[model samples]
Target: MTDKSIYRIVFHNQGNIYELYAREISQSAMYAFVEVSDIIFGERSKVVVDPSDEKLKAEFSGVKRTYVPLHAVVRIDEVEKEGRAKILPGGEQKGNVAAFPMPLKPPID
Candidate 1:
């Protein structure tokens, strides 16, 4: 999947809450599980993609790796630009993340 295809994932697990940034490996898969900190919660369970804004968010469910329609995701444009290649949220961007290079933009057009 492309970087724009990913966002932060948040959900409740066993009543214990957890958050992760999931990189969508494809339209059907995700990779790169990053724990999330400093999250914003509201009665609104959804957010919209902002073109001008570069930040992305993730969603998650305690029951499974994925739940809820990705379309329900508000921001769908902001993608992970991991140098040279892009990686979905649940997945890692190309390259050894251990080195952690700046994410590069994926060809979107």
Candidate 2:
């Protein structure tokens, strides 16, 4: 594969589904998080405006790398080209979509 190959990462975050394109996806050193870097987004063109994509761009604007929880990841695919990054609302209306629950901390004696 060429160095420019893009990867599409689909993951769940705070009851939302995030679709992102990046050049790198790997197991993070930070334990159970997946490391994603070199995120790719469609160029700003006057002809088209995607609110979902715009929201994602602003959310990840200053981030160089992101570590996503492994359990939240739904799928990952290597693609020939990058696509618009977007965030989709996910919940009961989306059918069977739910965020993983975190374990409760033990009570201090």
Candidate 3:
């Protein structure tokens, strides 16, 4: 892969759909998890600020790597370049695509 390679990762998290861009992505050592690192964000301008982008930046700040469950991932694609990283409303069902249902809590032993 070229150094300029960028990947767009879309996934469902806590009722939100997250769109993220990263330089590195691979299967995690942890079972059923995807490892993502080197997150990229759009350059910010003082003229305007996006709340969604800001929220995502704050949430992922200082995070070196993240593991996402396989079932939660909507899709991953290699794009020509990085794009704005933001979170979209997951509750709305615009397309036929749907997120896989997952239990909110683990069963008690």
Candidate 4:
């Protein structure tokens, strides 16, 4: 990836869908996790503010890096420009799309 690449990471968190924009993303050293860093947020000087964006900014503030379980990650995309980071209720998903079940541990065990 180029230095200018911006990543859009979508993940499932406690029945909510989190959409975030970041300058960096990679496989985490931790087992079965994806590392996200350099989170991007809109300028605070704007008169119009999105509540969801504010919530997300507060949630991730002071966090240098974050790891999302591989199973919880919905999708990751490389976009030319950053978008507003927000959270959506998971139950609001349209159509028949469903998250694939992932076993927590070895079934034989």
| Leading candidate by lDDT | 4
**Candidate 4 lDDT tens digits, 1-109:** 6779999999988777899999999999999999999999988999998999999988999999999999989899999999889999866447788567422332565
Q: What is the lDDT, from 0 to 100, of the residue 74 in candidate 2?
A: 88
TM-score of each: 0.24, 0.81, 0.84, 0.85
Reference-based lDDT, each prediction: 0.34, 0.84, 0.87, 0.88
Residue 75, model 4, lDDT: 91
**Of 2 and 3, the candidate ranking higher by TM-score:** 3
Q: List model 1 lDDT by residue over 1-109, tens digit each.
A: 4434444553333222233344442244333332332322322333864321222223322323444333233233333532211123433446645322323345769
Write one digit per residue (lDDT tens) for candidate 3, span 41-107.
8787657888998999999999999999988898999999888898987665677875467325435
Supply the global lDDT for candidate 2: 0.84
Rank order (by TM-score, best first): 4, 3, 2, 1
Q: What is the RMSD, in Å, between candidate 4 and the native fold over all Cα? A: 5.1
lDDT of 1 at 35: 31
Greater-TM-score candidate between 1 and 2:
2
How much lDDT does candidate 3 score?
A: 0.87
| Model number with the top TM-score | 4
